[model samples]
Target: MNLYDLLARGFPADRSRPAFLLGDGGEVSYAELEAGAAQVAGHLLARGVRPGDRVGLQAEKSVEAVTIYLGALKAGAVFLPLNAAYTAAEVDYFVEDAEPAVFVTDPRSFLAEAQAAAPLAQAVPRADDDVASLIYTSGTTGRSKGAMLSHGNLAANAVALHRAWGFTPDDVLLHALPIFHVHGLFVALHCAFLSGAPMVWLPRFDDAQVIAGLARSTVMMGVPTFYSRLLANPQFTRERAQHMRLFISGSAPLLESTFAEFEERTGARILERYGMSEAVIITTNPLDGERIPGSVGYPLPGVELRIGGGEETGVIEIRGPSVFSGYWRMPEKTAEEFTADGFFKTGDVGRRDLDGRVWISGRAKDLIISGGYNVYPKEIELVLDELAGVTESAVVGVPHPDFGEGVVAVVIGAGDEASMIAECRRQLAPYKSPKRIVFVEDLPRNAMGKVQKNLLRDRYTDLFTAG
Candidate 1:
């Protein structure tokens, strides 16, 4: 069984129903979506992509990008989506590591070539345990590990979210998030696909475009940045968002301030969910019940969640069908990430309330979630240390009103902040670059001689929020 087949199981009986409502007021029907996927699948096969081979794609968000994802599934190939914002240097690392059978940089040209091939009549067969996707998440050591998500994993999470969110064909999703991350690629797209609902598509989150889509859409899934940006504008008033039925946020911690302000402005509380690339979605606030600020509600159906060490608040561990199988080609690393009992260590510090609701306080790892993108401190630190006139650097995430967390670098060196930042932007994705740099004589350290990032974080807690 293929994951695409599972997604199609919930499609509306009529294939002519609109699937994507374009920003220009055009529509792509479900039948057209199917045909596009078929063509792409046929082309992938003709290009020597086997069932288990990886198909890497780094392109701007477009309808063709979505079709490539579906096409990969139809061809039984592992879909590897790289962030479009990734620099060529960053993209080279993923290309060298994943070694995809075919990598497409331009979706329009790729789609044109795909259209010339005969459409595939049927989807290639796949097993439940077969890897469907490889989502690369950075380790604390500055290395990227590919999380291999199986067909069963995606199917299970999609089914769970579709039910939990109460999606239906009547729903119209306001799609604005980028398709590279799990939040956009799997969680948001799967729910809409399972319900056979139409998505009012936007290339990216634009204040004007989102305001326009909100009127015609029933649901919106975004990062905290989206809501924060919307609230910054006077046009995103209660009246403008009165028709929206659901506003979901994930991929970054939604600040309590944003949550309360959004509710005050829209007369609706945004549903916050918890997830990672290893697992598409783990927990979410209830759709029909109360959605408390800063609370990620409960684990999805069939998921077993616990705080590691059995303390009131500790590292979160989970065992569920939706959890990814393991890191690709990293058996030792995968084994270290899981418990003897098979629970995956989430590395996130959180507590489960007596009522079973989960609230994430912070990450045990120094993972900065800036504007919904994961920025590993080591990755940035490595780049910073390699730069000219650098002695050492510690990257920390502090509170930011817009980005949820703003990346800051404390350096003990003689480099100009502008030059260092410019150098970093050249090698890394924009989001991963430090927003601000502070030169220091020395970094705070523990008795063990390890850099105390906690001290750095505490010292700069109000760096962005302060007047």
Candidate 2:
């Protein structure tokens, strides 16, 4: 039941086939990938990493970094990937919490040592329910909790996404995403591995590099910021993206304007899906169907989704084979997140149609209660985004004198505050309209391009309270 074995079964018969096409026009063959994993596995075993041990990696993205992940899988060790941008203090927290057998900051030296060690011939055996990875939540609210993803959890998700996206050996993926996140690590890499396909790998998302890679690649999976940046560049023409078969967006909400303008510019609709760190990928807009803007489409094949509170719109709860068992070492906290009936409460506020389509409004934490009325930030932001002179907007609730919380709109482009407020007043209820519009050149964002609303809330907490 080892996940490494399942992925290995899909390796190309001709091991000479390219698995990674690097930026320097060099190629890493499938045979080399397998060998690297074997050596790394052996090195981990020699270093006293047992089957259930944790292997923490916080290095920059590279072929060696990916090999470490596969190596950990082969050794039956739980992989813990962290963002490279985290400070020493931040790394300290994860270290004290997860306590990996070996935390490697210098991957190049580690790979050198691994290459010199004896190679393990095959993957170590693991049960289906054995923990495979620990994906820590972003922890905007409190301390980060490690989500325990089992071998069965990851394997089920990998296989489901592989079929849904229609991967084939002939496909050449333009891989520009960071490997730390689920969108890049599990979803993108698994699809390519499952089909024995090659990936035109880039260090990160660069407009020029991505445009050039598009000529030789058939598929591209990226966050919303990647698509928005591409559209901003004049070189990203229809002809440049004409040959691409799929452009999938996730890890953040895609602006409807970005969705429409991308279609207008490239003549291809971006497939936007919804997922989080707890679950790899829960729902996706159809690979072949009407990909309605603002909809995350339907639940994956075996997932059972329901709206909590039994309203048209409430919290989304899900139960499935891919849903993680619980958070690592947080039994009480884990119990609080799941329903009594066993559904994992996805703190996102959304609704499901009778036909099974799902549309996410916003995060439950982001919901604003103003003047004794509930106000959803997404609704206000949607209206603000459509107004003139506004490139984008983020609506957040701040402490107020009159209302319990005042609706404040933080905008990204030029606009008159009074005029914008008047426009909002016309379209929305008085309480729903922004009490103050704070214009900023750019909104605060995390690595994956999701607006850090918590930061926004903190930054403007005194907006209505300052004397």
Worst 10 residues of 1 by lDDT: 445-454
What's the C-alpha lDDT at position 213 in model 1? 90
Q: Choose the strongest candidate by lDDT.
A: 2
Q: Give all TM-scores, in the order shown.
A: 0.80, 0.99
Question: What residue runs in model 1 are displaced by over 4 Å at the alpha carbon?
Answer: 367-467
Off by over 4 Å in 2: none
Query: CA lDDT, every prediction?
Result: 0.89, 0.94
Local error of candidate 1 at residue 373 (angstroms): 29
Instruction: Estimate the overall C-alpha local distance difference test score of candidate 1.
Output: 0.89
Clashes of each: 0, 0
Output the TM-score of candidate 2: 0.99
Candidate 1 backbone collisions, by pair = none
